[model samples]
Target: MNRRCITGTLGPGLLVLSLASGAVVRAEPVFSPAATDSCVSAAYASSPGLSGHGVLDCIGRAAAACMMTPDGDTTVGMMVCLDGELGYWNARLTAAFAERLADAEAQDAELRTLGSAAASIEESLRAMQQAWLSFRDASCLYEQAQWMGGTGGGPATLACHLHETARQALKLEGWWAQ
Candidate 1:
């Protein structure tokens, strides 16, 4: 077991790693999902019919708030905050994907019933989603690579993940609407 202490703005984030299984555990501060969700909700409320990248304005509010905290001021803390936001976006992405897939399947069924030989929308959606995932991973990896193994790489990668996830989530969420 190896333990490393990364200092934050107000305190320290303890990072623990186990050599045998290649597992890592970290005690770091995470942003509040309620706060982030509230911010996003407010953005939508303020801008009636808000969709697409317009929702991005609310993306970093909670992370910025978390970053202001004593436990979130350090690199590890920032990563945790970014991870929290990424998780939020991931949830949204999952829901949006499910909704879109279901809609596509329904549409395909309708087209089949009508004897219209249209292409499979569900298959196209699945392919696009897979490609997006690959693109997001590769793009984030490139962003991290730009840091050259520096400590900044971790946060950069996380930020990239957050950005990509949020973008995809919003895009998928508004797909049928647009």
Candidate 2:
């Protein structure tokens, strides 16, 4: 067939066929393990160090998996980031509490009671973190309604809320530490 005849004959029908194929093309993976490892290592290397703990490894793996998922869904990515941050924080707090508990053995009975109280505080802090995450997601949805023109406000607002939530959670963590 001539070029124009072939092109004209195959145009709309071909488009319909392609649309009906029920196939979805996916983008490339957004996260790399080497990159994640380097980033996490540099991020936590100095302050509030991990000290060869397996929990840090778990957090890193979860983060990398979340980032690498092929869905390209920003909400899922945000949720993953929040989860990874909480996991890391929880692990760190638990490790710190364990260290303190180990050192408190030689103290008086009141000091032992204080150690138990500290454990309860840690549990409370974790629960508060979870509640803050729920609130953050809901508030972000409410705030982004004003800027819903696909101007990237939804993800930005969500990220901002996550930062604020993390800040508040960390503050609570500081209290728990004492």
Clashes of each: 0, 0
RMSD of 1: 6.7
Segments of candidate 1 deviating more than 4 angstroms? 1-27, 51-53, 175-177
After the best TM-score superposition of candidate 1, give how far the Cα of residue 133 lies from its true spot, in angstroms.
Answer: 0.6
Clash-forming residue pairs, model 1: none
TM-scores vs. true structure, each candidate? 0.80, 0.36
Q: Pick the candidate with the highest TM-score.
A: 1
- What would the per-residue lDDT of candidate 1 be over residues 41-123, giving only the tens digit for each residue? 87777766654345677776777788877668778789889888888899999999999999999999999999998899999
Quantify how close model 2 is to the true structure by its C-alpha RMSD in Å. Answer: 10.6
Model 1 quality (TM-score): 0.80
lDDT: worst 10-residue window of model 1: 4-13
How would you encode candidate 2's per-residue C-alpha lDDT over 43-139 as one tens digit per residue?
4554354333332333345344655565434554544444554545455555644554444443434556566544444454457657877887777
Model 2 residue 176 CA deviation (Å) reads 12
lDDT, model 1: 0.81
